[model samples]
Target: MAATEGPTVAQSSPSSTPLPPGMVLGPDGKPCRTCTDWKSWSKLAKTKKAQTQQGGSGSESAGASSSSSAGSAAAAAVVTAGAGTDDTAVNATAPDDCPPDREVLGRATWTFLHTMAAYYPEKPNEREQTMMKSLLSSFSQFYPCGHCAEHLRDEMKKEPPKVASRMELAWWMCGMHNKVNTMLGKDEFDCNKLDERWRDGPSDGRCD
Candidate 1:
């Protein structure tokens, strides 16, 4: 059977507050809280003020005591959510080492998907091709960003995955990514450089 499970769609909370400009919408046309930047999700300022205790001269990051008793708990949360948000006002600004937010999460996910496509078998067998297609479909259903999943699912329906060869799938995935980047008002990557970006690195041997 095909992957049919998807996020439980719901309406966005109807409050006096309006969604921020870059807000993401779910399949049911609701504001997707998990798919939006943390900053947009709340109106409260997230930057933390430096503590001014007497004789305390170190910044938050430089402080050796930064790892409080909550370190393990925070790490576990990050492991499960793929990113951690400091809910406390005192720690609102994400630490330099903290987990990724929505934007960071999307970038990392795209990198993994593109790289995997680049390395797909040159001539996939029947089982491999079917599995690759299924993987894409299932990923669209369960992707963390609801709007992104909807967009990907719609795109997949319009143009099914091309798994005839590694190069074909790689190029197709690149084009789809560029579509997303464009919609997000970001620069579109050059499809011709897929191998260089994901597989071989640059020709300058910088990665070597």
Candidate 2:
């Protein structure tokens, strides 16, 4: 009797390499055109496609949620990230803790008065004269004679007044008095009395 033949391996063509296990040669003797390992490849392709679709859908949903209400979107994002709401609450209440508006205004007024006193100088021009008068007048409103007497006295000792016009001298004196009053936080004294005592006196005696 003839010996029984085991299953024969298909011969590969000269131009083709042999297929791996679980693969077979096609009629052309190339690896099989039909996917022999198709199950895992198909599964992986499906998973990747699903992931791409899921990512696109997630982005669209996020955009829609944000458009629905900006504040709600922000709150949702914050909560989803595990942050607390205390910071927002604190920011909302911060303005209430500020100082009164009037006190701020008073401080700003005093600052302007002090700056003008330090920088303003007598100029022969009409504009300069007008500005000096205006500055002095504004100062007087905030710092009357008695309020500023001590500061005025100190200033006079530092810089004696020269022979300027009576009006010019008065303006200088008023500015000095305002400076003193603002520093001391008191009402200014009488301008007429100051003038009477110091009109013929040395420039430094205006404060005294």
Candidate 2 lDDT tens digits, 106-171: 344444543444344534466666656565445434432222323334465676442234455555
CA lDDT of every candidate: 0.62, 0.39
Candidate 2 root-mean-square deviation in Å = 37.4
lDDT of 1 by residue, 88-159 (tens): 422333455655546667778888999999899999999999999999999988987765677789889999
Candidate 1 lDDT score at position 80:
24
* Overall local distance difference test of candidate 1: 0.62
Worst window of 10 by summed lDDT in candidate 1: 46-55
Candidate 1, residue 152: the lDDT equals: 83
